[model samples]
Target: MAVKITGSTGGWNCDFPRRQYMSPLFSAILLLLGLCLANAINFTTVYEWDKYDFVWPSGVNTSNEQIKWNVYFEYMAVFEERLFLSLEPFRGIPATLVWFPISGTSTAPPKLAPFPSWELHKKDNCDSIQAAKGMETDRDGRLWVLDQGSRNCSSKIWIFNLLNNDTTVRVHQFPDAVVSPSFDKRSLRDIVLDKTPDDNLAYLVDSKSENIIVYSRKTNKSWLVKTPGRKWVSLALSPIREERQLYLGKSGYKELYSASVTDCELKNEGRSAAVKLIGEWSYQPYRMLIDSSNVLYAAFFNQNYLCKWNISEPFREQRIHEVGEQDTDWPFTFALDTNGIFWMTERNDTGDWTKPRHKLLMAAVGARSYQFGTSTDLSLRG
Candidate 1:
């Protein structure tokens, strides 16, 4: 079943995810006198689902085990007004790359329609998406998807023009050597891109291989930045073009590291990138995102609450915008919208796999994506 989700929990789901109504605050002691706001640290639930409803194709045997198992969504990306999400290859997921229109309102839970079309999402079909794990979008109306591949396929990078009826614009499969044949080298944790260069460079972090894979759309090539012993799972790329930095977050480590995006690009510079320890946090960190305002938004692997720090400052708990509640929920997958709204989802799946314990929340933080720009459309959709 592939159709859009229009349901709203009343009047909450359709608000502008971004806004300019930032509260005034003063932190003069840190020299960022009026930079941080308290409203930026707290989030509220916009949509709640006890379990998701899929619009399945007609005549499909829903009783089949393969199509009747648990389904979990762990990756998300918001483009214009559409909130794109990917379900883990949890047996019953019919389509991994699906989306819902955030502007619509309905009483039932939103339905996720497969991107492009359901025909292009056929399982085991090499031409179709085998498994879509992570995704990121830019202001240019381009959606970057990381397909983790299946038995007869190899990991691939997919670029779809969201502005052009979600057309497939480019598909680059990673060569065996680039993704390593021996181990789970293609365990891509996340994907991010630098849209300025002609090469159209994109970076992916391999959680299993502990390396970063860089892909170039112009050259149709890819390379691995080896990290042999580390468990580098999450990564964030700076939006600052003048001085680009790719920040690395080790799964259970307290330190955050970085490397110059310029040095790790595709030109075959013949030199290994020098990794630098950018800063350290009180607790181990997980996923990360950089806003257009140059602030680093981060989630901890162990902490329930989220925090944000200006890259120019040290990543200390005392210096971050933190919510003091016994924050026990993690933003399983989150994305930033142009309106400075931080959207996150929390999933609580337990013994009863049938129960849906998922929530889509949003926090207007007074910042936008690193891509930097405003859309003419006042609505979340651009």
Candidate 2:
């Protein structure tokens, strides 16, 4: 009495909906069926260095001399239920990939597997160059990889999905010629699934142009979310805003801009339209997530720090969590999960006056709830 489900690799069965057909075997398979549902996601403290706990399938650390690299994790996504991580490297290819799963409180560290070596040249559909700054997955399970095209002026966005019944790979190409309005066509920092409030259509962020090209499965006509003042790469829908607007942050720079998203259109240069200056440091603000309390958690690439901004209140005081030194393992990209924990990619130091030249390091920070401490029961945890 096991229910069969088709998976990517092989077929597996769980005792559930199929038990009705064979009720006699249900008693024997009840325990096994419970394990299948419980093992969906479990977290573990397997990654322990000194005092901090890490997420699973961490990067292989070379040069065991307590070395930490300062680089950026440009792209991050959950691919096929496994975590796909990439980083900025030096002397070799600029990209590396790590495969793992979403870890929970009962999860274990991912077992190490043989990784395919970084390729140097472009092959058929999947290019092996470097500088993969952004990555996003479509609802249909297609992966869209955005390469910086840094080395050869190859400002291109590559799309990859499975063909031949999910065996052979397929690719689609879009050149920079029909992409944007800016001349600094170096990198597409990040990709977001744009969900319009009014309709079922979504769009992707074209960072260089300070505009987002809207794509609808319903109609083929395209539109743009234009911001007149500055360019934006990281976009997040604010949870605390009254009108439920979109908050956009600049990539590779220190700035946070807000625009109301009504009917999937940006209400530009209006009274409700206001920009919040988090800081003036020159760093890339890559990925952002809105917490349950309406706070904006931002990760700065150049600086290994996690910035917390109170969007619900006036933007006067903001908290910054600097991890590594400017010349050390500065974070590049980061995300916060439902548990209020911060996950980031840590890179090796790119030497003084140099750039990042190492593999990836995964790190996490636990969030603690603080209360108003006084003569009351309100106390803060550190």
Candidate 3:
């Protein structure tokens, strides 16, 4: 006998043959299968670091007196087998960028170190990093660094080619026009690279100014968009194919507004334009991840749950996993691998902000038994 199954509950239910249902052994086997399919999500702790484990660079003084000072790590990216981490300049520590191999032993995490001196210097100046928070690696083996320059330095984006001997390829400084007059300093938060076959673009978020700055590699020019009619205080961009969508979120607000990609062409002189509202969500997302299947995963700011929403019909949110305890520090920034696993950094919330505790974690969302629709995976290059 054949059975037909369909719905949002993962297509676990079916109309079985009447004779098969009557058999006790057959009924028991079916029950076990259903239970296994329901519990597909799993969370694992990949690496954990105590306050004393974070070692300072070779030149920096690691004496007991200096060790008392605090060090905080912000965003991270993975390319091949290497994991890159950015150290936020908190409590007088120099803003440093470092990376270590991911194949280290589980009992002992790899040591943290600064990026090579030759790659960091432009001409004669060394220690070019002021304050960096977000970074992304493209398919062409280039690592994009977003320096906020919150420490009185100029805001700039540094692109380094990792595949070709780790060479510094380009450095683009934000023009004065991109900085808003109302804010005392420019806060360049996150970066999203869109490398379509025809277009190469970078979308940088100005969280404090409520605008987005677009950079074109072909023209080597940058433009700013106000995102008219949308309150984009917590702006985030996720590009899928030719479509680049914007996600807006606020701290206390319970809703998220999304807009379609602006229609501005790269060849046009005026690259800035307004975006049209396409969708909205009931929960406020601090960080977002979309899979190959167009399934959206969100980590909330005020809540401790990791929520998943189906972009297709019946856009309902399902709380897949709980990340942390109530009113605690949760995953601030996260990245999704091609295999559908989430790599996130969890900071300590209870004690002093300087000596914050951190953990590198991984969560896997298993495949569903039901077919939702046709969708494609988001490429890191784009």
Candidate 4:
């Protein structure tokens, strides 16, 4: 499974000159870069974790067992040079949204601090994050979180202004008719943001409900597309707004599909958006994302490999690389930093549960995240 955007997603129009149509030269350059990334790139270990060491709030009642669990790191995003990770608020997890500066690299397990503050991560506060699986950051320095509220908290979308030192929070609680907190599980898994001068939109995957929920900032309302499948886990919008596409993948399926983001705007609560089959992979990609170059990257389920392809080309041409030597390296959350560094968190499935065996790794390939539009020559600026 490969994930990629066409380029031009809101907060992502920075990497290159925005164009309504991709020039032949631009496509060639993206192809070259994608090939360069497959040259057995050396991945550096920024830090590893066997147990998640969160900065526990002073007054919170957390059992010590919470830190040592084999809890998985689901999603990650980078903003303001800091890496943010979302830990699902499961049986013993304390915080769902946390971050640490990429500058201050620690040799020991990185100390994950609650974003904004510990106060904002208190479970069931309703005012805070209860459960989260996916998160994203934009060029404007805003952190967007999709909180799949537990039974105690209602599902809501949260936006924080990192530009203001994250002092402000804007939240939108989905109406129960479209989204209600589930006691058995969190339905909303992934979120993608599309921002432009004309409109601000968000697309999300409701796995259990089998729906694609579209929300608009302009209207301050949400609509649902009762999708055809049940496990719609992977999602992304084309980086180029003019050719916007919503790429999707399922947990067990090897094929990836896409739909037009515009077709999902219908106010019909039960409408189904038309989808097109993009392509398939030899292995199953459980999670994925795209880079500014329109290069789609995928992390296989419980596999030691990570693969990528220039979406402008055929899926058969995708370049797959073994990111690690360990069989336990189960890659999941991944995002590209501003400098073209590939960052991801991997779970050591066979490691000692008492220690921090999981690792956060980085590799440079001269590529930026799709959130940055496309590649550009900075010299052209001044």
Top lDDT model: 4
Model 3 steric clash pairs: 292-377
Badly placed stretches (over 4 Å) of model 1 are 1-40, 62-69, 182-185, 264-270, 318-331, 350-356, 373-382
> Which lDDT tens digits does candidate 3 get at residues 231-285?
3434445535455555555434556656555455422444444454444555566
TM-score, one value per model: 0.78, 0.54, 0.73, 0.80
lDDT tens per residue, model 2, 82-134: 45555553343223433455555643344322122333333222455344555
lDDT of 1: 0.69
Q: Provide C-alpha RMSD values for all models, in order.
A: 10.2, 17.9, 7.5, 10.0
Better of 1 and 3 by lDDT: 1
Q: Write the per-residue lDDT of candidate 1 for residues 35-67, one digit (tens) a residue.
A: 333223566767878656666678866565444
Error (Å) of candidate 3 at residue 242 is 5.3
TM-score quality measure for candidate 4: 0.80
Q: What's the ranking of the predictions by lDDT, best on top?
A: 4, 1, 3, 2
| TM-score, cand. 3 | 0.73
Instruction: Using TM-score as the measure, name the better of candidate 1 and candidate 2.
Output: 1
Per residue, candidate 4 scores C-alpha lDDT tens digits across 1-382 of 3323332221111133345225586885565445445344577888876666667668765567656564667889997578888875667676778888888545766677888787777766888888877788776778888888777878888888989878655788898777755656547877888775676777888766667888776777887886666458678666654676778886567878887765534334678877778788767776778877777887776676666767778765344455333455345679877777888876665444564457778888676766567654422211
The candidate maximizing TM-score is 4
